[model samples]
Target: MYAAVTLFVFMCLTATSHADHHHHPCHSPNMTGFMSVMTLKGEVRAHGAFTYDSMGKKLRFRSNESHPVNTSIGLDVLMFFEEGVFYEIDSKNQSCEKKALQCSIHPMDIPDDAKFHCAMNLGNPSIEGEGFKANVWTGDIPGKKGVYSMSVTMGCLPVSTIYFMDSTTILFSILDIENEIKDPDLLVVPSFCQGQPLEETPEGTVNTFYNEFI
Candidate 1:
């Protein structure tokens, strides 16, 4: 259970980094898409549907995850930045765990300090088919011993992100993104999660993926 919870938090942190540049004309402040995450060492794998609302400071991730010792878990996390809390829900068990947000929530956008790596085509660009032209950015994770590389389309659609931390490598990929969130209540905290006492407060500076980057 501890491992599962840790993975859930890690996944949530990883998903927070998306594509939005103020200088760029195109940006995705609201998006819903499929997300897949995996570790290079094959220690953990998760895939799910996610909704991100940068304007609303909310996020929702419903995922089926497998990790540490081949345990499978189903989790739904709803994050509310304004409330400074997040709820971890187990739909099958009708249980919810409320926890304080360990790190300040920021918009799901590339950090301004991120260095532009290059602009390249993400796929085959042929006469009959034009591939996605994307900009790549790299940055060191603030207050953490890691670095991240992100690729996004010219229109500010997230393509992929790779985080290198210590000796572990994690990859995050998004696909089939819709620029508008379809479900109006997707970010709402479930009734079961209401009035629950905070279960834990994560300690350590390395708990967040984009800590202090803003």
Candidate 2:
């Protein structure tokens, strides 16, 4: 009976660990609209306990590789402008051809309720998964170039955004109060995206390819 009980407990623990591993949300383009690219410089302070992921050969976020100093470190983040489009990447990473891979524009499919303006206010956000949630807030992030504030609730997680600058340059700052530091190394640039001159595809559209470096 003792041995049986021990086996049962071990099984339960394994099950729980497996369940926790599957919490990452799906990241794909769902919303559509014009795309814009820019670089952001700032300091990252882990307000709470956070862990960075360094696995995944592609799309890896390797925050654990180097222990990020608690002090202010110069940061360059790649920003993609499109409703519901968010990706964090090292903006200083360059391509072999000497092109700045700091950021890229990924076009999205527009939603029926999509609106183009300076502000959005969405209440009662929903959660998509572990470390993933859907949120809405209003701001002049794409146009007008003004400071706007927004709050989003994804799966009960509250996220806030502040639009600090918009003009010849656009800037949006995001703070995840309850952000779980899952591997920040998950989003490393693929080698194919590293360096290449402009080229046309068979579809007559221009796109860049990145190699798997993670």
Candidate 3:
């Protein structure tokens, strides 16, 4: 689960450094509302909704992911992002954990085979699809060198509609849209799960979790 989410998030967006924020299509100036999004990557498909404010300080999401590794398992995730912290909800234990997803990378530490990947970028000026005109950007991800692309519509809402790793096409799209989110409280972790954060999920636990849910 950790590897799945981190791989999706960190490798996304334009090659432009994070410092050039205004140009990032994913960072819509109007992303501050509510809607449900569905994403399909590789063999995993996830559906969820989010509510956020304009400041980008708070975002709450609830989604279910496809079972890729084991057909018998299902994964439903509830997460909140604030400042630089990522909080994942463990409903079975009724806890909001902040440490389970932390990871670091050192380019020098990676083996040479892993370093052969080339960076991907927006192919050209974004193209539009179907009913309306939306910006489309394409880039490639390192997993077998897949080419990925996304589209953002009105209010700056975006989804990764097509991602091809090796020879497979992974898709992400918005299932539905609505204005005005009723529950503002969704932006914060539930009180029952608040306090000191839980420890990082151990590698063994991660393996077990994925074994059950992937």
Candidate 4:
């Protein structure tokens, strides 16, 4: 159980870095890594700004039609795994509705620390990507339940992504990864999830929107 929660938290939260503030790798592990796979559910705020091309003509702005990105809001995410299988919830809204559904674990990347465990110096490393440089700060998650926190550098980017048909058509993206940690008590499986481990996907999908806008 411990191992499962640990993996779940690290895996799901790690992938979120591309969305929130850009997180650079930490030079050292600040908190003791969890030995269990945890189920994490919490809120994160996403903020972004964009300008439509005038195309030499003024486009009238409509309040209803305009899908202005959230200046800041929280998100609820879940992490669960067992029997070598894993599951995650990538809800679009804090309310956890289907219509607001974002992405699932259909295909995601769980970075291989052994493969890319680049040691970062003090503070947070500056990871330069597209239009942002993720500033990652490694530390422990708040509360005594044993959690880790990695604050990504928001710099200038969207808070979350709005998915499209081809996965590349992202309407919004996460600005940074605020918090990540393990919770041994989150054992009950959510009815909306199915546990089945799948191959890891590329990180391009997570960063696609950031590259396009930033």
TM values, all candidates: 0.73, 0.21, 0.49, 0.21
What does each candidate score in C-alpha RMSD? 8.3, 19.0, 10.1, 18.9
Q: What local distance difference test score does each model get?
A: 0.63, 0.27, 0.40, 0.25
Model 2 Cα lDDT, one tens digit per residue, 24-75: 3222221111111222333333121222221211221122224453431322
Question: Candidate 1 on 54-119: residue-level lDDT in tens?
Answer: 777787877645433233247577777667777778877878887766543222456667766656
Task: Encode model 4's per-residue lDDT on 169-202: one tens digit a residue.
Answer: 2222222222221332233334544332354544
At residue 168, what lDDT does model 2 achieve? 29
Candidate 1: minimum summed lDDT over ten consecutive residues — where? 205-214
Please tell me which model should have the higher TM-score, number 1 or number 3.
1
- Indicate the residue-level lDDT of 155 in model 1: 75
Better of 1 and 2 by TM-score: 1
lDDT of 1: 0.63
Point out where model 1 deviates above 4 Å.
1-27, 42-44, 65-72, 104-108, 123-128, 205-214
Which candidate's lDDT is highest?
1
lDDT, model 1, position 15? 54
Question: What does the lDDT come to for candidate 2?
Answer: 0.27
* 155-184: candidate 3 lDDT, tens digit per residue: 445533344555444444443444345577
Question: In model 2, what is the error at residue 105, expressed in angstroms?
Answer: 12
